[model samples]
Target: MRVGIAGGGIAGLTLAWLLSESHEVVLLEERPRLGGNVKSVLTAADGGPCAIDLGVRETPVEVSPVWRHIAAAVGVSAGDLVATTASRVVLRKHERSPLWVSAADPTDTARPVTTGGPAYRAMARFADESARWETEGMSWDVTVGDVLDSWPLPSTAVRHLLCALPASLHGCTTDEVRSLSARAVGTTFTPPHTVPRTTYLRSGNSSLVHGLAAGARPARLLLGTGLRAVRRAGEGFELVDSAGAVHATDVVALALPADHALAALSGLAGAGAWRTALKAVEYREVTYVLHHDPYGMPENRRTWSAGNTTVDGNRSETTTWYGPSLGVDLFVSQLDHRAGRPREELARSSFRATLPTPQACRARQRLGAIHEGQRLLFLGHCTTPVETQEAAMASAVAVAQHLTPCGKRLRDYLEGG
Candidate 1:
């Protein structure tokens, strides 16, 4: 079979790599480079050129079985993985004090603000409640606001965890966070009993991208060629490229975002259902700025953690990632439209992310039905919940399972075989 993959991100790359073993694969990317959101940058340092990931950074190994399997499969040595503790602090604008802080590291002299108080009790309660909520199998339509309203949490706790924290993580406004699915938000922010173990690629995420590309060995790797449109041929599909060229393939897997994928299928017949579902998946534009200045950190440097979020009214909450892994003062801040550009910005890039609203989550569920009995398929964030690399890769694995005989073998590989 001849497979055509659109959008050369992790999902597309993984699908191509899986299919290339038995089929001729052609991967198309609009950008000149691969690794769509897995962008890493090198900066001058005293020891050497330190790599900083401007896009996807850390992966929690416990929850990221597929990512771990892929990294190891691609020859990523154990030395390349650096284990790190994920910590966070939340601050309000113009306030010298922090609204909430995780337990301080042993090296820090400053004590945590919410060690024992209403905020502390609220945090503890939330953890327990969210865990129960998960086990209770809460409805998908339940909004974060609905959950928060039911809780007897203090305003500060609500601001810190449910509002600012999720807003910072998703690169959306606090108000926008209210409409998001409680199940999704709970899955992300629910505190575990112990500190979760996470890891970062010592050389950066691009190493995995390079490995996938090298292994995939697609017959035609078309970078800088966007998929303009898709039309049904007699038995297969015809993909129109940006340069006015049409490529025919036995199967088509669109690993692009919902909007991008929908736009390309404008010429396809019987695509109304696909278009409607795609439109329900709302997206927000997030800009990441890498810089030397602490644009979004708390006023006190001692309270700094791996992730620092600042909450301000009507503005999107900003999260700054302090580069403890790089052993440098480098910082990456996620900003929305409201937050102005950073002063000492070294580099800036923007990306579109799907908001996991109840509507959007429902839309994602319908994608499987839309692709039923059709050669056209959807993968990546469009087909999965939460925009993590692990989810993206898992979606690709599903597609590979559907199209090839090695699907069970691949699933076993992802399950740590």
Candidate 2:
């Protein structure tokens, strides 16, 4: 049978690679390049050659199975696909005050965001709520506020942590999201605060995508293309392209996000409830700054919330770090929409806000990249409130399973032989 896959992301590519061995597959991607948000930038210098992870930065031990399987299938070791290291976490509520916690002693128990505290318990509760939603078949329609209210926590710290997870993950406050959506994240992966960050990849982290692309069977990739529409063509389905071109296929795999898939299938035939489910889902915005620093920033600097500094009612969690040699990465959500203000100034100010007010502090800016456009089906470890690669992989599997029965076999193949 001929299979047409829309959106050649990790989900789409994984499906296509699995099916191509036994079927004819045509993988369509809307972007000029693949890899979606797993953006990696390779350094041009020689010798101590290294690559920094600009996005999808962390791969915890809890979620290594899928990524490990992908690496193996593509004929590379997990280490080959990542740069693993111990992460030093720093805490500071007010920017440039003092480093409350550091890797030198992350267990000092003085910081607010420290693990194994009220924050961790709240995370556990959130995870439990997410599991409940999934088992009850209510994961699709719930909100973050719903989950929080259901929790039995009375501590202010616990409440703050609960509120922070969804807002940080989705770039939106708890009230702005569905309770089920928030739960979906928890049920999907380990709550972020509890997961171990042991993985980093070289070649800018895009190597995995490139590996999958190369390892995939022939006639699998159809880049710079999108599914414009779908219709019945004889016994099979006719998939349309952006320019109204048509390709008939026996099986259709929409690896695209819920929104993109729903839009393309609006005029297509069959699958009413599925369409409704797809339409019910939504996405959020995220921004990050990837910089190359010859002089490393203080280890006391890391990720924190900026909800207190917003001009409007919105707030953001700004996460920053230096992993590979003088490299600083900042991930900030809930950015203000001010077209008149210069982006560089805002990023610099945000960066400065994350640092100590030392008069002698000197650090050079590297690269700042932003993805402000509407995102689709971003139900993964990175964007999801859950903090495990397992959640992201499971969400992908669930989405795939919803469309076809082939998902089981694909999942099995990814898990093992």
- What is candidate 1's lDDT per residue for 58-127, written digit by digit as tens? 8887788788888788778889988877777777777787777774343544645456766666666667
lDDT of 2 by residue, 297-387 (tens): 3333332221112211233243444333223332322233322232332222111011101110111000001123311222332222333
Over 4 Å off, model 2: 44-49, 81-143, 150-158, 177-182, 187-195, 293-313, 324-417
Model 2 root mean square deviation, Cα atoms: 10.8
State the displacement of the C-alpha of residue 75, model 1, in Å, after optimal TM-score superposition. Answer: 2.2
Stretches of candidate 1 exceeding 4 Å from the true structure: 104-110, 337-343, 369-373, 407-416
| Prediction RMSDs, each to the true structure | 2.4, 10.8
lDDT of 2: 0.48
